[model samples]
Target: MTGYTRASALGPITEFVETRGGSIERIFRRVDLPLALLDNPDLPLPLREQFKVLREAGREIGDPFFGAALGRVVSMKKLSAFGAWVSGAPTLAGAIDRSGRGLNRFLQTATVLRFQVSEAKARWSIEFLDPGKDGRFQNELLGVSYLIDGVRHYAGSGWTPTLIRSTCVGAEQAAALENVFQAPVLHDAPVSAVEFDTALLSATGPERKQPDFGAEPPIPPPVGLREEVAMLSTIALLEGSPRIDWVARKLDMSRRSLQRALDREGCSFSTVLEGLLKDRAVALLLAQKRSLTDIALHLGYSDSAHFSRAFRRWTGMPPSRYRS
Candidate 1:
């Protein structure tokens, strides 16, 4: 596993941007984003730029979870449609039942959906889908933050998550994820998750109400945000140094177009990829007890020396010195 989860909540980012007087056309041009994308709410924008846009204008959006801000505006269209088909049949539980979509039709870019459920608890997780190492935990935190708003909207109340769990262990403690979720966030236990108490399942469909939580403001609508994120994902996708062809295929862009996109974003593909690779290397070395040689292999270095040279170039020191 790449140890990543896909964040599909980005479907509404455009709308969020537009709402805040962010220039859609200027943003499109600025970000090297095509205006045609606005028509296709289901389109997957690039990931690197997406993170940049989110982090760049994050505070303005009144959301810490970049993806969640988008999810706040999205209605689970598939689930809503399915629920409407069985309208007023019985409780909200009956209306929704247990139908699941492999893709959460509600999200376009972020790839997440409700995968499973229990009698009282529904367990759904978004693959962080991070190429940079350790976005897993941050991504999970962002997802939960978004879910808080989402659950409240559908549940028609300020429904808090009963529990939270993560594989982050000591790291999650450093992040204080509980402050974001405002629920019991359990670390080093199992998978990252947000748990709803049993009664939420039975809430009727029509009975579902949106929360009083006012939506956040729009962030800067840079066109390149999605493209930036896509590049980041591509960098993360490659095991080590990646070829232009591989990145082009992953981004569904021609080599020339990819180059142009990077230029427009004021970045180069190689520069960005090198940064992410080094970042991942440093993160893995710091977070895990794995030996240096093992870390080198995981990063796709043939031997420790090669990785050491690259690591030194990326950082100022060899991996061992950094660890110490």
Candidate 2:
């Protein structure tokens, strides 16, 4: 369910460049990115490169406010629009559902926020969903950390996740997860998720009114749900038990078309599949309660030995060692 694409972050990013009299080419060379990527907005680049590019550009102009302002353009701005949409919902949950639909209208880069609630607990997972299996764990974790930090920037300083999860493991990965969530992060969960007081999600926060973007040009129109769902489902497919062919069919596309859609969105099916296996293998291994052979079967690995090799490739440690 994931493809890497530029997914325009609005003219704010472009404006950031303009403000400094800098061109996008400057960022390409400065961040070691491919300039050809600019032609396709759906292609996702490095999150660290993204932040660094913006952070450095802002710093070069000596405006910390630019980073905060860019945040406003991308996600914080949408919270307000969503708040307006839900302003009259009878309950907080109604507002969350309403707001959830507009997620792409705000954050278009490597991210997903899934929301679910029941009588007992409310679950919302803010995932920095990566498309390929080709990112550093540290870089990916840092993106997640920045997202939470940015949300806290708009939400509150005290915000935290109930359960922190990662697609990687080992003492190093575990420590990064802990630092990001600022809580006891469990290493072996099926996904990166957070449980919270659903009530808080309902509360009237800063998201209630659209903020002016100063001088940034208008953003491109929002992409469709089919496109978003396809992208999401593909990323999820990569990170976990890759289902959602059913979901894609609903979009009136064959599995192959759906994959092409994903590729145009900057991802490939095979990459996501391997990422799912890597994530599952790591999580299963770290939990340690499962036997190696059982873990292999669970991950759809041919057998224990194959899973062991994959585990070693991803974590530089054997599943047996992780279990120990």
Candidate 3:
């Protein structure tokens, strides 16, 4: 899957920038992102663009430790559903395992979370599959900080990683990171990981009061061309209308090749895009109390009237009727 991240994932950075008197609109424009996109935390953002925004925001503010600093302020409440579920796990080990299964639900592509338990230590690592990208270091920092924050929420604020390793940091940034993590920070490592005492895995943590709805159903691992395209379309739809060529480029294939692949699956790109939009439209109508105009604009409609026509076409009823 070409993974996507929720726009809310940048909440800490957004708060940091705004507090520093930085213009978030200018930052969004610099990254070719719509300013209104951040309004809905659950909205999916292309992982590539998410990284670009982070890197640009950091560069604009001249803060080398931007990611790490942001991580410190990020709370479980800001992490959305995934964070809540992790906090509810009975032990630190359980949280790590649950996070592994649900990582894709949070980030749709280009990132991975793995948990390994050894006799001496338990290692939880996050790897950004795309290393050549601009914000690799910042992402690494952010990921590690997030893990630490989650652990502290349940394990007590005193918990710390036994060792921290990153593939992206340099000597200058290492000291700042070490101070934040309060653990040895190794730079230019093979993978970005946090190691902790194995004993801590079995240590009980405070129980979190999960909502009655419980955790989100685990997403099945995406496989094959159709699923890959569907995942990409879901991510693209969050920003605006999904484009076949854009999805093709994200999949690293030419437009013709992408069309041929869809043909083999007995579906076309337009069908996939329509299906995704309809699903998102229905979801927003039922789940959120947002006005029709806001929902329409979110789905990339020029206005509510256009959205109403599309909704009627999809469900044989206008969006307002469907909501009622």
Model 2 Cα lDDT, one tens digit per residue, 1-324: 332323243234666567667676665566444444444444333343454456555555655334433432343322333324443344445454544554444333455667777765666555545443423243334334434443343346677755555555666756654653566666655555545555565444444434333432222332554445534443333323446574454345688887777677677655556665776677767776878888787666678898889888877888787767
Clashes of each: 27, 19, 2
Model with the higher lDDT, candidate 1 or 3: 3
Following a full C-alpha superposition, what root-mean-square deviation does model 3 have from the true structure? Answer: 4.5
lDDT of each: 0.52, 0.51, 0.75
Instruction: For model 1, state the Cα shift of residue 249 in Å.
Output: 8.5
Error of 3 at 152 (Å): 2.6
Task: Order the candidate numbers by lDDT, best to worst.
Answer: 3, 1, 2
Which of candidates 1 and 2 is the stronger one according to lDDT?
Answer: 1
lDDT of 3: 0.75
TM-score of 2: 0.40
TM-score for each model: 0.43, 0.40, 0.73
Off by over 4 Å in 2: 1-95, 109-112, 126-131, 136-155, 210-324
lDDT of 3 by residue, 128-230 (tens): 7753476767777888888877667656787788888877558867777788767888888877888887777776667664532243343444567787788
- Residue 38, candidate 3: C-alpha displacement in angstroms: 2.2
- List clashing residue pairs in candidate 3: 3-108, 3-109
lDDT (Cα, tens digit) per residue for candidate 1, span 150-192: 4554567556777766555676472565665556767785446
